[model samples]
Target: MIRFDRVTFTYDGCARPALRDVELTVDEGELCLVAGRTGVGKSTLLGAVNGLVPHFTGGHLQGEVSVDGLATHTLPPQELAHVVGRVGQDPLSGFVTDTVEEELAYTMEQLAIEPKVMRKRVEETLDLLGIADLRHRALRTLSGGQQQRVAIGSVLTAHPRVLVLDEPTSALDPTAAEEVLAAVTRLVHDLGTTVLVAEHRMERVLQYADRLVHVGDDGRVREGSPAALMRDCDVAPPVVRLGRLAGWDPLPLSVRDARRAARALRDRLGDAAPDEPPATGGEAALTARRVRVTYGDTVAVRDVDVVLESGHVTALMGRNGSGKSSLLWALQGSGSRRSGTVSVQGRDPGDVPARVARGLVGLVPQTASDLLYLERVEQECAQADAESGAAPGTCRGLLDALAPGVPADRHPRDLSEGQQLALVLAVQLTSAPGVVLLDEPTRGLDYHAKEAFALLVRRLAAEGRAVVVATHDVEFVARAADRVTVMAEGEVVADGATADIVVSSPAFAPQVAKVLAPGRWLTVEQVDRALAGAAAGEPA
Candidate 1:
């Protein structure tokens, strides 16, 4: 149903082609997953399938690309809208209407379908994606995950045969991610709709993929079965790594298979679970008492009291609308706090100048690129230095440490989502604030980038800086966060050490923990250490 013949695409001034000599095919009703690290042109490849690459993005193209017997070169995106449905990384970017229902139906209206048919499709899609409750809500009011589902439903309503999704589950909680993936599975199996997805979170979608299309860092493509591609890939799920570490003959992609395969390994390391990461040890770096925030009639955050200690990393986790983002904003003193007192280093951040407040407490929002407006990375770093009154290379140094090898001359907008996040984080860290709050910091990051980011978070905590991250990545929280704080419906429902919180909550447990249940092993690294010590005949 989809074919790419020697396709090569290059941007206006880029030295190398974004995608070079790509040749692949996706049969009908197949779910082909595009796997690669950030900045590896996975998005560019997806755009080519729907004719958005050279047409909408204004890039140079070579060779042929066709979907459903329609050549994208001849049929522009508008002409191919009936056959292709594309959902981007940011759902809000493609929104054309105010409410979910309207957005879902607008595409059919543009395609000039019958009103009755459009309405029927809209209703079916709402139910299909389990988003009927959000039909009346304005797009802006919905949480990030809700917006993602609505974005997907809006495209699905068109009833296109080919669905192209980029980072569909990046911002979603575990439950929401499962729902979206299940819906996609139904589309592929029940409806014969073909899906071409590009995602960095392999653990969420790998099991659903029928085939794997890997784009390497050198602009090359390799297509194979999921197991064959994943065994040696630089980026892999924790289960795959666990298999490799345990010397399993074949890696297990899902938790069920991993658990079944882990019986023998479990007996070898009998009940020797490692201790959880140490808690923060310094004095309280920030404190919030009776914090409350409201939007019109909606109470987003309600009387939440919290303390963040220096030299610790706290992960704020919950459902999409659980007020994680709002609480973080209010604590940073950037957003409105209806009735609360937030003290950073014995003073309220809102009392200081905006420039001074940033130095006291820095924030990297969910959309990390919003903090960047400069033309180049160098300009952004220079501006950060000026704003923070730090050394000239302070921010650049932080960027290199967090994500190495980002070109200073490149535009911040031109960077990949992961690189943009790293740049924003670097800009925030230059201020040398006592506390750092990052919302969804690892959104588009691959395994390697996430590892680098986790190390950076640990380094900051060790340097006596309080760190807080609001994210949905359970693996990330297990690896990086010292403490876990779970919120629900505008209140702090659970707060404790990471292991205690994640292990008890089924929704938040990482893959390793799920495999080794009734035990406290949270990560593959912990298991590996235990085994190594056991091999050396030492008590684990």
Candidate 2:
């Protein structure tokens, strides 16, 4: 069992405590979910469990934190490693070896285990995580999802009684997220290991959590079962949102449960007819004709021909290293486009002046918030808007659209990762350019914020502002994308309507696709419509 007793932590140089008077617990063999926006003491709490908070972090820690009857304050992280197997949010942070199999074995070797035992354990964990195929792969070559899995697998090889994972799926695509969660579920059910996970993607973890612990920015911890707690929390899952809208008894936690309630609501209230598809043949906001980009001797994007229609959302969908980012940069005129033409409203992106391009296209790069150097959120937005030639008050209006009630005085750097992303989005969108490019906009967001972001993207598209997102978030693609483009090895391999391409293509299909009756079932709405159609056709 792990317990925190009124724990408050302050970094050595900081004025504020990262965590304040937090109390939480995880029972033996229990699966507990630690949830909140990013930087809300979730990572700190995980570090505290492993003695990395005050010990390695050199922080002023008050109160007690214990793991398995051992006080973490008294034990060094290395000493506590025997009981705690931690997979940090940053996959690179916990690595000790260069290869997948070797990384799995490294911890056992550190514990002075027999080589034969280490090898057996490594093999078992690789097979357990369904990563035996990647056993010989170099750590650097693996996709973010694969790297995260290897990180988790490496620790699991130690067979530690307690496993703490921090946002293990942040970098994963939807299918890959499912694979990781499946393995984690197996660990709790089959191995009887106690599991504690910190994540923003709550929907992916909700079904597995025996208990939910919500951590506030002030470091207050609230613990209860997922059903009871998330039902009341404002930032709950879409299924919860549907439940709230439909007025269901005993709020549903999963999509499957929510579907039944939705069907019942449809029976009582009558399903709303589907809206007509938006008009086609608007002016092309952005176009890439046979676009190719190469890095040194290697090609990153090859002959990718595509067009982003004005006022539509186009999602670039593919696995990591599939040239999604390359395509986005090419469209935004940030990367070199060789052997092809990229145009924004008939103007060549490469030949157009930077100031002219700024008016035509705005890009929110992946980790774009890292570019923020401002002290306050509002000032940062205003400064970006002014520099971009946007009219005054545009930034404030954009912020109001993104987050209506958020305080502008809050430090931009101090905001949660999700909030920071929204802030950058406001800065970019305030210019109201012909096209907006978002690279992995939903990458680090939790289930609640992801749903909100999806809504926002749709709203932008509806306003006749072309929006393009390069992301592996299949769930978001299903909800927000009008078109899906699949890239592999720096080439455009597939492009079509979101539902048709993702559901029909085996490689790019999300995990939810596997369960749904195929034929363009992408979003929950699509699934519902499909079910409704089937029901209407059946003899009653």
Candidate 3:
């Protein structure tokens, strides 16, 4: 259904070709997952399907890309709207309607479908994506994950033959991500829709993918089955990594397969207990008492009381719309708080100036690009250094450590989602705030990038800074976080050690923990260490 014939595309002002001599084909009714490192042209490849590359993005194209036998080189995006539907990384930027129901119906209206058919499709899509409860909510009022579901539903309502999704589950919680993926699989299985999705979180989609299209660093693409490609792919899920570590032939792609192969390894473990996270003993870096955040009649956070300790990493986790973002914003002293008292270093951040707040607490919000305004990356880094009284190149150094190879002259807006996140993190960390808050920081990061970011978070905590990351990436939480705080319906539901909380919950457990059940293992590194110790005839 989709074909790329020796297609090569290069953006204006860049000598390196984003895609070079890419020849690929996607059969009808197949689900193809595009995998690659951050800023490695996964999005560029997806954009080519509907003529968004050379036509709208003003890039040079060689060769041709076609969908349903129609050449995209000759047809514009508008001309192929009936056959192709796309959902981008940032859902809010693509929204045109105010309410959830309206957004879902807008595409069908544009396609000139019958009103009855549009209404039916709208209801089906709402149910399919499990967004029936959000139909009447305003788009701006919904959480990021909710907005993402709405964005996908809007495109699905059009019933396009080929669905192109960019990070479709990036913003969703574990259960919600499963629901969205399930819906897409149904489309492929029952309705014969062709799907091409580029996602950073491979764990969620790898099991469902019929084919894997991996984009390498040299602008080359490799295509194979998931099990065949994951064996040696640099970017892979936790389960696949665990399979490789255990030397299991035909690397497992799902938790079930990994668990089945782990019986002998579990025997070898033989009651070796995983090391517990070190207990936090530092003084309180920030304290919140009776914090409440409301939007009109809806209460986002309700009288929440919590304490953040210096030299610790706390992961704030829960289902989507569970008040994680709202609570983080309230604590940062920038987002709306109907009634609350936040104390950072014995000073109320909300009462102080923005400059003072930066010293007290630094926040990398869900929309990291919103924090960037400068024309160039180097300028933003320099400004951050000057404003924070830090040495020049401090922010740039941090960016290099977190996600390397970002061009100095590139526009912050033009960077990929993961690169934008790294830049925002570098900008915020330059202030040397006592407390740091990151909301969905791993949205666009691949496995390797996430490993670097996890180390950076640990380094920040080691420097006597308290860090709180509000995220849905369970795998990341397992690797980076020392403590876990689960929220539900605007209230803290569970708060404790990371292993205890994540290992017990089925919805939030990482792949390794699921495979090594009956043990409190949270990450592959932990298991690796235990096995190594056992091999050396020492206590694991």
The candidate maximizing lDDT is: 3
| Tens digit per residue, CA lDDT, model 3, 301-408 | 999998999999999999988999999989999889999799998898898998798789888888888889999999999999998899999999999987889999
Report the lDDT tens digits of candidate 1 across residue range 1-540: 999999989987788888989999999999999998878889889989899888887879999999999999887898988899999888988899999999999998988999999989989998888889888999998877788888888878878899999999998899888877888898899999999999998999998899999998877899989989888987899999999999887788889889989999899989676767775558999999999999998999999998999999999999989999999989888888899899987788878787777877888898887888989999999998998789799999988877777888888998888889889988987876889999899998888888888998999999999999999999999899899999999999999889889987789999999998878888899898999998998876
Report the error of model 2 at residue 392, Å: 6.3
lDDT of 3 at 180: 75
Each candidate structure's count of clashing pairs? 0, 1, 0
User: Of the pair 1 and 2, which is ahead by TM-score?
Assistant: 1
Give the C-alpha miss distance for residue 125 in model 2, angstroms. Answer: 2.4
- Which runs in model 3 stand beyond 4 Å of their true positions? 116-120, 123-137, 141-146
> In model 1, which residue pairs have backbone atoms overlapping below 3 Å?
none
Candidate 3 Cα lDDT to native: 0.91
Clashing pairs in model 2, backbone N/Cα/C closer than 3 A: 200-446
Model 3 poorest ten-residue lDDT run: 143-152
Lowest-lDDT window of 10 residues in candidate 1?
272-281
| lDDT, candidate 3, at 367 | 85
Candidate 2 global CA lDDT score: 0.76
